[model samples]
Target: MEEVQTQRESEQETSDESAQSDQDDNQPIVSPPTQPEPSYPSERLKRAAHMLFFKRGRVPGAKAWELKAGIGKSYEKVLDQLDEELKELDLQVKKVEAGGIGEYSPEDDEADKFRYFVRLRGTLTPKEARMSGWRIDNLAALAAALSLVVSKQGKVERKELEIMIAEKAGRWRTLTLTDTFLRTGYLEEDETGMISLGWRTKAEVDLPSLMMLVAEAKPQDDDAEAPATSSMEESVPQPSEEQSTE
Candidate 1:
């Protein structure tokens, strides 16, 4: 009886061990903890970012010294550091000259300097547009005006644009929309008063995507013909019964 009891106890222990082994096998495996990302730059860099990203009026960006007091320090280094932080989001702070490289004159005491501007890794995607704090209407107007400019192959006559907008939203809205585009640096007026695509359009707006969108746009239905046909019918006096009989 002792031998039989001992064997039973041994078997029970084995079963318990097997059960624990199975529980361990059923448990989920845990991965190692990931390292945290580095922190953003100082308040001055943050301020620069705010101005570059949020301020649409100041295209290309503001002066480095104007951003903060520490002009002597490595401003470029700080901008590069900020760009590294923004890299995760596919954005960067690019240093742009005010009016092209030729415009930079060391001879002049007050010549234009490099300005820091915010740009995406790729073209200005809809995601960037939404993130840039632009209103829906603003974007729509831009798209419309840009489409016209693109269709014209770079420039659209101001008079033609005014007429087009006047037909839809009246003359006042045309002025407002055009002025807004101009102010935002998306449109530039040439000496001839023609509205052309601005420098920022090239910098920010994706030309390829713009062309593709314009190409894929659905054509408006031929409702003009319907209006014309109805007007012609009304203008043609109907034949009277006596005239018809004759």
Candidate 2:
């Protein structure tokens, strides 16, 4: 009877241990939460500076004053922060000296030409402004017009070009064929009213490879019915077995 009781006690202990192991396996695992993304103040200031410089074309002083009035920061502190960011981006601050400045104005120059009556100043050339890929319609029209001029062998009458472009592309396009070519530096008109490619267009002149290929294929098509080689080939000298033996 004691042996049976001892056996029962051992079995009970084993069952309790198995139950504890099952509970441990069923326990949920808890992990640490992820940290949120950090925002950099310097990066924000750099973006704001670039906007001021390129978009507004304002000097540092004017930009700082605008920022202070608009965003509630002192001009001096904003300027210092802007300067630090500009240094990090490898941009230099240019100071213009003028007599008694209430508001700074760009000086006039004889060489400078206005586009659509807006005066462009400081470092940004007219070509650069046009080439900045900002005007898609202008670029497309320019490309199409220049291509028509080049394909027509360096000179295309303006009216003829307009008709062709209207048929090829569509009506309601903003740029005229002449305006397009003018913008792209491809076509120019003389005083006598003859339109021709400009210097830049002349520089790019070459026989287009596609045109050359088409020209070559034309002769082959014309001669398709003719014999492959000349009849004179039979009269040409050929070494025979008898000649080799001699």
Q: Which stretches of candidate 1 lie over 4 Å from their true place?
A: 1-60, 63-78, 88-91, 95-97, 100-114, 119-138, 151-153, 167-172, 223-246
CA shift of 213, model 2, Å: 9.6
lDDT of 1 at 29: 98
> Largest TM-score belongs to which candidate?
1
Q: For residues 136-177, what per-residue lDDT tens digits would candidate 2 score against the true structure?
A: 555445555666666777677767767766654566553464
- Against the true structure, candidate 2 has what lDDT? 0.51
Q: State model 1's lDDT.
A: 0.72
**Tens digit per residue, CA lDDT, model 1, 98-196:** 543223466543423656678887656777768889766667767778878888987889988777756555566788888887877788887799988
Candidate 2: stretches off by over 4 Å? 1-144, 174-177, 204-246
lDDT of 2 at 15: 100
| RMSD vs true structure, all candidates | 9.7, 19.8
Scored against the true structure, residue 222 in model 2 reaches a CA lDDT of: 38
